[model samples]
Target: MKVLALKFENYRNLDDAIITPCDGVNVIYGDNAQGKTNLLEAFWMFCGGHSFRGSKDNELIGFGKPFAKLEVRFFGQDREQTASIKFKGNKKQVEINSVAKNSAAALIEKYCAVVFSPEHLNLIKRGPSERRKFIDSAICREKLKNAVVLSKYNRTLNQRNSLLKDIYRHPELEETLSIWDNSLLLNGAILIKQRMEYLQMLEKRAAEYHFGISGGKEQLEIRYLSTTNAEYGDSIEQIHQKLYETFEQSRADDIRNGCTTKGAHRDDAEILINGKNARLYASQGQQRSAVLSLKLAEAAVLSERMGEKPIILLDDVMSELDSKRQDFLLNKLDDCQVFITCCEQSNKEQLKHGKIFNVCNGVIS
Candidate 1:
């Protein structure tokens, strides 16, 4: 996928900005807080209907502005299309080709993007939630229905937690907890199954990429460690049975802790380098390499699944890598449309045949 053009109105500091990027690498260079990242965020929101930065719709609007609007025209799957997002107060709407989409998933089904930011470099060191987000996002890119599954699981988890709090307050409510338990088990089982399947594919591709990046000196492995110990080959019935049993086993702790203790929400992906925990043993360079490999694997998987490359957004991440690693990243992304944000102008020499846009104080020139 390639972004043909983008326009933003009242979006953060990028008011009335427009950019037409190149089909290859589009280098966006500017000083700090000059809206380079905001430009990438606009494209991300246009494609995904949400911010990778985790900002709410209201927070995405410029100060003193009542709303934010973004329009993007792109070519994907051999055809051109347009996507627009309008956010006002707490409400937002998405449109594709002038047709309104009922939900973000509908928009995502039409377009998909993958982003790598500074935060993603700490994937191995951060908590499990971040890793889960990475897996879930990749899964959603591959299959939009998985987004609905994840949303359903989260909602059920929240409802189950609320019931746990009620049970803590009124022990009599404990008898009624089975209702939420069944719902949680059903949704959580599906999530566990999907995550494991995707992780298997991701781990294979990531290991291959990591081995090449590490000069064949290290072997990377990723294991899906579910709260219920559900295996990848397990049937949904088997997973549901195990999850239901685990929920029953953790009832006492769940009630006392006022949370659902055993579910997909607590699942984790354990990354190991040569049979050692990467988080505990990997050096700084090793950690960055693992993240790079994971991200490249994500792009490869999406390309294979979608039959077209997803637009790659690199948000000020080149500054964190050395020249050699930077070269490797750029060389690996030869087939995808890339947008890279950097604060240094010297890096422009590395991008030989791409558009370079200058951004300053929300203005792009």
Candidate 2:
């Protein structure tokens, strides 16, 4: 999809203004802390996700302002649509096409975007939770129903943990743990199956991208690490059986620990660069390249599943890349709408064709 216009009032550090972007590449350049990334964040909010920078609702409003308002008009699915968000005192309201929405997440079905911020480097630099979130988010975007399954999984996990804590004090209540375990087993198996399938598709596309970014000298591999010992080709039934056994095996330990110690929530994925774990051995550049590859692959997957390309947002991640890598991002992403934030004026000159918006102290021109 493409963003035709973004209107902002009392949002972050931005002055009240409307921005019209080109259909292809749009370069937003400015010095650090001048609201360059804020523009992209405004566009991303329409996708029904929290800020890429992890800002809270109250933090999104400009200082001395009581509220913030943002609106976007975009072309997608053979039509143009409008959406608006209003934030006041840590609460927000959303509307799409003049119809009120119960929550901002309702916009996910109407808009799509994939963002790559420097913070996303956590996918490799941090623990397994970050990697799991990356895979889960992509799956949710591809299949909205999976989002419900994921929510159920987390809820079941929390309930199970709470029961485990209570079981420590009252042995009679231990029987109810079985109920939560059954729900957890079913939901966890579904999650494992979906994650395995998504990673299989993602690894192929990411490998190709990593190959190009690394000049074909490095090979990228992604392997799912299921806590239930479920392999990549395991059927859903097989996965469910394994999860059942795992829950049985970990029951005592879970009760003693007062939380779950196994299942999908505890699983992870390994990112290998030429047979070595990127998290442990890859250089900063390699890690960044791997993240970029995975993000672009995510966009590719979304395009295939959605039948239309999702908008790409790149936030201040170019200076660390070499010319070859830079060329790939600037010239290789064809038929996709991209918004890139950079501090250097040279980045704008690198774009052969596109619109450029300069930001200075919250003003865009």
Candidate 3:
């Protein structure tokens, strides 16, 4: 997918701006706090109807302003399409080609974008929840239906937890917990199955990229840590049975703890370098390299699954990498559309071929 044009209004420091980017690499350069990241955030919202920076709708709106608006004209899947988002207070609306979408997942299904930021370098060193978010986000991009499934699973999990908390006070509610258990088992099984399958595919691609990035001196291994104890090759039925048994085994403990455990929500993705836990043993450089490998692998996997490349958004991550690593990343992204943000023209000589935009105090020139 290519973002042919982007327009923003009352978004952060950017009061009102429109930018038409190139089909290839587009470098957005400026000093700190100059709206470089805000522009990319707008593109991200265009593709997925939400911010990757974790800002809420109100935070995304300009200070002293009541609302924000973003619109994008893009070409994807062999045709041109327009996506627009209007944010007012806590509410937002999404439209594609002037037709409304029921949910953000609907917009994501039509257009997907993958983002890499400085925070992602910590993927190896962070907690399991961060890694899970990485995997789940990639899966949702590849199969939008999984996003809906995940939403339902989270809702069911919340309800089950609420019931578990209530059972502590009224043991009579214990019997009602079975209803939520069944829902969790059904949805959690599918989530576990999809995660396992996707991780298996990701491992092979990531290993290859890591091998090249590390000069074949390091080996990368990824495995899904399923709370259900289901193996990678297990069928959906087998996974469901395991999850049910797990919930049964953990029922008493869950009720006492006031939360449901032993489900997809508690699962993690284990990353190891040469059989050593990367989270514990990998150095800072190695961790960043591993993250780069994982992200490149994600782009490749998405491209293969969608029959086209997804827009790549790099949020000032290059400033964190060395020259060699930056070259590897830029070369890997040559076949796709890329939006890169930087503090200055450090890499201008290398990136001079692409379209360049300058940002200052929310204005782009």
Candidate number of the best lDDT: 2
Evaluated at residue 199, the lDDT of candidate 3 is 88
- Write the residue-wise lDDT of candidate 1 on 1-365 in tens digits: 78899988999988596789888888888899899999888888866578888888899889999898988898886899988889998688889989988776577666777787888866788889989988887887677578888888898889888989988889999988888778788888888888888888888999998887776788999999988979989989999999989988998999999998778999899999999999999887888788878887888788888887888888876665566666655555567788888886667667767788888899999
Worst 10 residues of 2 by lDDT: 325-334
Ranking by lDDT: 2, 3, 1
* Model 3 Cα shift for residue 301 (angstroms): 2.4
Model 3 vs truth, CA RMSD: 2.7
Q: What is the TM-score of each candidate against the true structure?
A: 0.86, 0.94, 0.88
Runs with alpha carbons beyond 4 Å of true place in candidate 3? 63-67, 88-93, 98-106, 169-176
Whole-model Cα lDDT of every candidate shown, in order: 0.84, 0.90, 0.84
Q: What is the lDDT of candidate 3?
A: 0.84
Residues 245-347 of candidate 3: C-alpha lDDT, one tens digit per residue:
9998999999999998678999998899989999999887788788878887898788888887788888886664566666665555567888888875666
Candidate 2 or 3, higher lDDT? 2
Query: Could you tell me the TM-score of candidate 3?
Result: 0.88
